[model samples]
Target: MAMAMAKLWMYCLLVCLGMALNNVASAQGVNPFEPDGGRRREMVPAMFIFGDSLIDNGNNNDLPSFAKANYFPYGIDFNGGPTGRFSNGYTMVDEIAELLGLPLIPAYSEASGDQVLHGVNYASAAAGILDITGRNFVGRIPFDQQIQNFQTTLDQLADNLGAIEAAEALGKCIFFVGMGSNDYLNNYLMPNFPTRNQYDGQQYADLLVQKYNQQLRTLYNLGARKFVLAGLGRMGCIPSILAQSTAGSCSEEVNQLVLPFNANVKTMMNSLNANLPGARFIYVDIAHLFEDIVANARTYGFSVVNRGCCGIGRNRGQITCLPFQTPCENRDEYVFWDAFHPTEKVNIIMARKAFNGDPSIVYPINIQQLANL
Candidate 1:
């Protein structure tokens, strides 16, 4: 009887250990933000970026607007100076440039002499898919206006290189669009706005997605073929939203809005693929990647999953996050760079996911998959 009892205890212990081991393996294996298995091949000769602050390398800051980043502490960690990026260091554009063996694409607002011949960033801090969304944020450029800027830049490029050569260069280029976060967060969620108290969450999302599709179709008409469309990240869990919600937990109401918005984006991409000729629309799921990092922070060596590295106060969502503000000693452990944007380390993780061909996070295809297409 004693021997039988001993065997039973040992078996149970083994089972528990096995379960723990499996959990650990699962955590490590399924990190969607991890770098892809592809070697950095020169798939696209150049990259043109459009959208909002998430990918903005400092275009809006140069313009006469409150939504700017061309100041001290904004780029303290990036080349030891302000290069117009919202983060302390390099953004997705810079990483993509490195991956493609190209120089950093200059901001469209930068001096004409300083602009890069190959690429430019038309992203403004408060820009969005719709012109109406731009008015919500102080000093933000509208989407249609941004397209005009791109047209001007393209014309200049054509002047430097012949029109045919410029066309060829653009054909070999990849265009990356990262917008919509501000439209939902700054506009629809504002206390004074009717959307905050009036519209159903899903209905509001549908409206935004409809606007996004129109803007994307416009880009496609403008000779943009190879494309990367980044969806909204985990906005509900962002420190700014958490601070606003009654409970410190992520706002499910807001998350509900995000789900359908992302779904519509996926549907739009599918339609574009089916209808448009040579259209390679890739959707990068920024929200899912962010959720994975926050849910399993330990696997990513992050100790603190919540809270921004910058100060947290009543005005933390707005007035705080300045150059003089206190920053975390180890930024890698913190998911947010400021109240609104991501830290450089977190952006690196996102870039890796963007590189991967994961369908859940990256749709249509990733950098490797796009190479074949």
Candidate 2:
């Protein structure tokens, strides 16, 4: 009887040790932005993306909006056809899908034709964190309306995956939100909007942060736990802004606006994380990363960084970089794909920086580190 009791005690001890080890492994493996590294965890089986043209694959093509990219040259390099992405080929979203071992997520507009699977993109070009950004543009989907579309997409997913499964999917899935560039470029800086006089740079930035927090909280309430929040890129250095300055240099005026804006966003993320439980918000600093690549092109194996390859003139603004426009023979030399967007090679570099946990490029914490959280 004594020996049997001793064996039972030993077995219990072994079970306890096993449980502790498993817990450590699980904690170490948890990735908020992506699935666990090895032997993919089936937890987040989908990714629901929302934002602006940076992520908008083809949503605006169907929508009655002036901010449309569902035509030639937009997707010219993507499968030799227009996929509505404002790039020569795949976007950051497409790369994320590839990394997650998932199929390309269809646009929310095209969700009708698909098998109702993993994910859909609801990003619209010229959309902003604030509803007014779209309204100011006159005929674009507002951020609030975009969220409504997200709700519709979720409803359909729930119908297919069942309510509980849909909720689980959303809770575990990665939510990629990339926006705010248009808010600065189109709405606030356009000089016609009352917002320009109503709010100074700091005040405007604060307003945007508030809007972001409210929208994020809404998504959180809707069962979103994992979020990949991409901050605004360097607006001052874009080809268009350079052309506006006419100095053949980046616009300090625009940079001044963006600097405080990014700072406020960082502060907001911190406050949100503190307030919300189990909230994994990873801020991808696209500005700093792009700046580094542009400033030190040789370090990253690029030949040119100041001007775009596709467009003409010193500022890449002789004309809009359409299909008929003459493209530089070597695309790898330029940092920008067009007057406004980065080249595919640049996006790939940014994605690598995001995945590798570059502290400077990814503020607070990297996406991979956030996943561990």
Candidate 3:
């Protein structure tokens, strides 16, 4: 035990020293790796994450959800093996946290003590904004429930730091939401659900946005101020959808379904920022970024953008990446990691763009600017 403690101390010291050296290097001049600043900096004290498998990290590991990704092959390219991130390595939030000069946020299920100070990730695999969205997955926490979990985290924070300090800390933190994929994949588009028969694509989007509005307002009331809401990516381009396509191309019909959701969210964001005092919301154009990547694959070093890196059946997307499955060797050159998730390489690209891009990709203000504000 004493030896382990000594080793831990040494490791922490080395990490701290490396960070100090990185800051020194940045202070001298610009580094391409650090986009927000030359010198390393912490833009926000904490960053609270929400949503589904896209940014899940490891929150669903203990849950009974089939969406969990803690087994082998899932994290083949990450820090050794699986840390519950859907990506091969880091998720978008992981890269975003690094950009913020903060350590990776702990899963809400595992966080304790000072861990909450940095923030907590409440995202779960197969979870969605609607309570019934991922019901097929059994134990996945929905967005509303994720928020409720966060509220519990807040209560714990208040317990540790007192109410005033906790509230102040929360008000200044960045709130990130990246969801809605499962709602389309597992609920609306699924033949088992009556969603398609009951409502058209645009009307479904409105329903989602309305519930989303209430969810975001709830977060606002809970002291969240800065927000980064990632618009849905082109669902039709995913490996799962491509596998279902007879032409082995992106399904324009499925793609059209998501367009209205992203559009309405932008309008909702504008309204939210305008009405909520001190609230600053940044809308990230994920579909735009992804479409560009697919269109210009060679420019981005991707040789295969339609199929996933791992899975079974057509496009390796009929099923999610399976356990012990030998993932593709050239993971960096692929866009999708599995049926429903992007490779870590792509995740980094998305995070970086959302962190610093202009209005073309991120509207109003980018994450870096929002963090600075």
State which candidate has the highest lDDT.
Answer: 3
Each model's RMSD to truth, in Å?
Answer: 13.3, 9.0, 7.8
| Tens digit of per-residue lDDT, candidate 3, span 88-206 | 89899999999987788899989987677778999998888888897888889999999999999888878766788778767768899988888899899888888889999999999
TM-score attained by model 2: 0.84
Model 2 agreement with the true structure over 12-108: per-residue lDDT tens digits = 9999999988876675443232322243442346678888887788887866676766666666567856777877677887877666656788888
- The parts of candidate 2 lying over 4 Å away from their true place are 1-43, 113-116, 134-137, 312-314, 369-373
What Cα-based lDDT does every candidate model obtain? 0.73, 0.75, 0.88
> Candidate 1's C-alpha lDDT?
0.73
Q: Where does candidate 2 have its weakest 10-residue lDDT segment? A: 30-39
lDDT of 1 by residue, 67-185 (tens): 77777667767885876678878787678677665578787878374254547788888887667675655677777778788888777767766677666556657888887887787
lDDT of 3 at 340: 88
* Worst ten in a row by lDDT for model 1: 30-39
- Model 3 TM-score? 0.89
- Candidate 3, superposed: residue stretches over 4 Å from native: 1-41
**TM-score for each model:** 0.83, 0.84, 0.89
TM-score of 1: 0.83
Model 3 lDDT, residue 188, Cα: 98
